[model samples]
Target: MSKRCLSSAMLKFAIAIMTLILLISFSFISSGAYAQEKISILIPEDPTFHDLDSYLDIPVVMVNNTDINVGGFDFLIQYDTGAVELLDVNLGPVDHCNWALIGHRPEIPGVEKIYAASGPNPLGCDFSYSTDTLFYLQFHIKPDTANECLTFPLRFYWVQCADGHVINTVGDSVYISDSVYDPYIGDFIQQDDTFPTIHGLPDSCANIPGGNKIKLVDFYNGVINVACIDEIDDIGDINLNGIPYEIADYVLFQSYYIYGPDIFNIDLQMQLGATDCNKDSTYPTVRDLIFMYRVIIGDISPYPKLGDDGNELIQPTALFVQDTLAQEVHLVFPDSLSAIHLIFEGEIVPDYSGPEGIAYNYDGIVTRLLLNPGFSGTDSAVYQGLFFTYTGDGIIDSADVSDWEMRDIASEVGVIGELICGDANSDGLVNISDAVYIANYVFIGGNPPFPLESGNVNCDGAVNISDAVWIINYVFIGGNDPCDADGDGIPDC
Candidate 1:
């Protein structure tokens, strides 16, 4: 055989080997995929879907058909105007869609409202009867893509209530079971305060004996904190006085069912309203209350806290909290603007006074308004222009990275600039207060603020004799000082 022929034969043999290897790899990949569990979408059993008017007061059921038991579930009910309401998710009585029930009367707690700052009064400021006719019902649940992989074939259902009221439902239960997936159930930190009252409904499953029945579970979606309310009437005897306190506003709450997994990190917002009962004021404005919660099913495993984000568990004696999580709007105007009433907007949680709907403000002027967290695009244009006016420099700077965090840390460190604790000698800062605080720690059985002293006057991390000398120089020796951390009060040094 010639050298060229031999070389050609070798090349063909090598090609044959490579082809065999490729075929083997492809077979393994396909087999592995096929072996994975499949998921499917589930929906309410028929008849209920055909007509919801017959089952207004009844519960909706969702069926899950994943191969592995799912811990819990969640879904969203988007309104025609693009408003999305989250349904109860802890898989029980119904899937996660029964959380939209508006009661004919108030029975829950903390959701009732009498007078809103807005213009038109819907239920009359009398706080009379609570009804469910004001709203249209709908919802949808998407998979938590981060925590779990959704495989094909995952299914769930929604059983409508039997109250005679009809709600428009849309969207299909998307199946996601075949692939390896996890649920993105968020985190929950043990808080000092009780969970905020969440207004909603309970899951309604069939009365099956054993084969996977829906469990009526209780869930905290969020809070509807009514920061303030105002009422007004013109040229007439106001019979109800200020606000009447509706039953629906006070009693509406959220309920759910849990079975396979736990639901956590729920949130809610209280809608504020300014309706002119007399219809004498300008067009009404809307407002909102921010709320949130977390669910823990049968058992709670270890989870991360907000501060302990990275590997370390930064245990804190006390955690800081804000009035709202999402951004909000604050209004500030000259004398003429004080009378313009402001309102908060959002969906009403279920409560007793009424269907815990939004609160509308009746009448009033606008003074200084501060929207917690921040504001959104829909907020009043006037409010968006008002910035937090900071008196004196260094106290706050928009460009500072941790300026807000530093203020909070200072408060936690006992230098809150309030009582004697912050005002050492009551003079305020580095002056006599600084000297007094240092003396007391050194000789008067007092403990110096440890980590906090790092931000203390004179740039010394520890309260020592040198700090005392510097305090004296700044207070009496005509030395320039930079210790006015906050320029509100007189410098103690």
Candidate 2:
């Protein structure tokens, strides 16, 4: 009786142990899966239910619009909390000739002026959810030559990128022209290595009356004038300098907005010839105005948020500064500037701001800082800000600390060896290899005026023995780095 009872009890214990082990294994697997997933939120700044200061409402993520293109539209994510984000934006084909913004100036090559379309009325364009899973918007041209009949089928699409929709094109070839007038269409223009140029014209020729009120236009009549110092030769006029060259001024005209579609007429009226030998006469001249426009893709809402901590972190406005002017200095954040500092170096100047001081003396406006070339031996200018150079993790609670701190800036990047010497070839840094450059200019170089001898640098002005000395001082002894024509300290060579 004892042997049977012992065997049964042993079997029961084994079964119970196995059941406990299975439960523990399942719990471990579930926990590991959760850890592998990333932490992603739709909005970095939760707008849950709060009193917004402005009319612009924060958008909620419609998870359905994840990857699907609504109609023929492209989407992008403007901002993402982490998990939800825009995938990509399709700008358009590569071949179209792009144009810049009208009246708006591009601070850099590829970037155009972004208009801050703010007011009390409803914005010209508003975004909304389309399908349950797709956030979509179609921008239609009001009507113009390409879409004058409103039948050009010119459309730009905004599709969900990550948490937001990116402005893009669905299909190709909706409109064709040297430069399209529709902002929506232009938004999809491909960004190329080469940037578009503004129609170079005098300001007088910019204000002509024609075309869509929003489109850019050119003004001025076409009658090029010339000066005649001597008798009017067959070629027409000669200046007092005795040089017979065309003496004419050029102008550019453009319109701001082209709402729908209308005739954008090009009137080229040329005036007869006139002469002012002494250079004191003013006559009507043929002027041309070229207008440029750039499409800015973003939420164009400008309503303010009352007691909004988010608003305080961002600058009231946006700017497209060039790298040349953006390289210098540490970006200032709202924290105190006395604690930490960022070190930056490059052909560009350093921009710095914080508790130490503001970059510009004009106003407390902490725009890009231009380092004093008078202090450094670089060619590029400095750009400073009272914010982080780029988006990143910060030490302070950026939302609460509104004033820029002095020590918190960090130089995240630096352009090394940007100094240029008498190399004459304009390459940064000087070495024995530059000797060939010297020989070419001295012996074979031909010109109306030989390369200025004083520029030889070595002081003999002969471009030979003297030039070498100038190079040595600039590179080693720190001679007045002549290249710094701007005196911001960077050698402007």
Candidate 3:
């Protein structure tokens, strides 16, 4: 308990307390440094030229100064209503932020509100980015603006971090100048204290031969203007109607040529343009009339032969064949066509029981099927597989295949002929023998029938006991004749 001992103990305690305080201070500084991240809204400093009545795209960019992930943001953009008119607000590509909501208040004419958030809700956005465009403001310069410069100021109303912490952010401003180039005068002038004016086409374009009826081609930078004369070349359509050349149109063309424009109540000049079937780029003549007659008789098509709406006419040429082994009638097309609709007139099988419902494949130079719904793939030229079903009686014959029609992609109807169905055995007749063959194949795994349609006695697609019973009923009980209902030389299935 001496004085020297008391002094030494007090000094040691003081030193120990100071060491602990310094360690705590160091820990606090380290934690603060790790949390020091910021977010901001950046506006470009460059001034854009404001062209009257022209669109100006102003980009609002978001800057994440920290490496921390951002969850969501709410922004407010204020513009000068008198200087520019807001047309549209579009969202930009903010990675991982898939949901966005935008609102414009017309009552507060110049203000736009935007709220965007990232996905996988609850956990919110799981992405980190340095900079990205938040949205675009499409504005049109007002025709009556007097200000030389328009300013758009951005304000971050609310910003949230991935951890659900509200963040404070800084925003910037964008400037657009009203001083623009006057194309007529070829000079830049400041728009001040006066309404803006839009430049019109040059005086030379005003005196074009076709007046305002000419089409403007290659129009760029408001300088080069080429006027093209519009001409209609619908061969055989002498009446100027929006249909294919027909007999009525032929008569009109002939009468107009023999007599004069006064011979008909229709516009003779327009009729001449339509009747120029040869497309020789000249007026209609006797040769054009002859061409129209040929088109009617299917000898030839009108020059530049096209159906309505400039689409090429589809004359579907189908080859109907019987798959003896499968016992299915396939209607094959030479070219690829889509949206095909076909009608079979006689008895034929409709459904197939195989794994391949109807066993169809696009086998040609391009053979790719698009599995996606609503997807029109590049291979649209060759399409196949149209199965026939019994319409009248279950009896399929040659007439069924011969008396069928198909509509091509262009909706043009075409007739098919010389094709036969219901000859699965290829024996030329559908009867009890055909039914027995089908049953043997289905039950005992006998030889498959050729031109498969013949084996489908019941026209139910598969050769089975049901088809055998159908044949027995038809042969003995007079139920129905197989492939001979109408008795026309062809099967109508």
Candidate 4:
């Protein structure tokens, strides 16, 4: 045996030992892999558009497998902070074990840990499962992710009795049985007397009895999608009066907030991409109302609220609410635009004007004119624009987030200026008294409007009771304005 020959032999011996070790290790490694095949973890298939900051639930299901008992189980979920905010979690209906436990403290930014055992001392009791959800996660989409399609990964970061698993062993060979077992020899598997029957683990049968020991589990990952709507609309238009982020919307939103949508027939769906004035939720809140108030009072700022998010929202150049009951119409500006113009077919009264109180004229199949081209503030003056209403059905109904989109009232009108479009009695203001006077003139043959056009509030080419009723609703119930003769978005008589 020369030194070179001895070295070669030693190398060969080392290789032989390493190969033997690997072969032995493969047996134990392959033992628990069957769990992944027998078990499954599934997330929700909720394709419905979940509004940002709206709450939702994600279920973790285990399906398509024969019944199996779990003696102990442990796992953790990973999520994205930008996409959702984890609120709470609930154990599956079948997850009731002797000592089922779960904790969701943000120990890690996006991680939630959970664990359960049949018995504390030995982690027994075996929770059986076939096809059922294992757990549920409660979350709300973050408002900041509005108008964005985001995908967050849902995966189990850790699973006990499977990952980093161990079995009754001597040194190398694993005693993979539930009963006190027998093993190969020294350093690997001798004779063991401990029980490793973790019902939470998958079935196994390697030198162990009953094949009820813990085994490795194969894991699958999934994703949840947060998407924008088919098309973006107005933000403040809770009632969808075609005016985004304006006084009419604010009024509707305020009403809805105070009385709820059901009472006012307000459609929240109309607020899809709109609403959320404070940018905290897709739904309206007190904070949003406060923000809108500030904007109206000219105290608006992005601080403490929302920055410019490029979401599509149509701001109504002018909102015309129709009062069919009072046979009246009222014009409003959701925003401030100078040199505004309004055109009508029936007629417009200069009994009420604004800022400079100037009226202009136009020529067409329908007369085009300036309803209020130079109004500084609408608080009192703008609210009174075309103050008319209609009581055709006896109920006061306002537009919602779905009714109509903001249509540009600016057109090639023959003339334009703010010159009191209503006031059938030529009063400085338009109110219920005007409705009464016009009603007297039409039905009772009493004193009629001085110009008659003042009495034609709806501009329907008539001074009938319908116009009086509309005006009454407008004054008493805040009816909509600028009645569209054909339901077209544009305001006209």
**Which candidate achieves the best lDDT against the true structure?**
4
lDDT against the true structure, per candidate, is: 0.23, 0.24, 0.40, 0.44
> Over the stretch 164-230, how does candidate 1's per-residue lDDT look in tens digits?
1111121112122121111112222212222231111222212322233322221212111111112
2 or 3, which is superior by TM-score? 3
Candidate 4 residue 444 C-alpha distance from true site, Å: 79
Off by over 4 Å in 4: 1-37, 45-49, 92-96, 100-107, 120-129, 158-218, 230-493
Backbone collisions counted per model = 144, 102, 29, 51
Give TM-scores for every candidate, taking all chains together and pairing residue i with residue i. 0.16, 0.15, 0.24, 0.30
Worst-scoring 10-residue span by lDDT in model 1: 253-262
Candidate 4 C-alpha lDDT tens digits along 1-493? 6999878756655554454344333432232122322444444333222456666556655432323554444556677776777887777444444444433455467877654444334433332334445566777777775536656665554323332122211113222222211111112121222223112223323335433343333334446666563344455566677766676765555445323444346455666336566443444433455555555556654222111211111222234433333455554433333332333543333334354453423232332333221124443224425633322222122222210111222211111112233465544467755666565556434445544566676778888877766665555444445243344555575
lDDT value, candidate 3, whole model: 0.40
TM-score ranking from best to worst? 4, 3, 1, 2
Query: Which ten contiguous residues of candidate 3 have the minimum total lDDT?
Result: 218-227
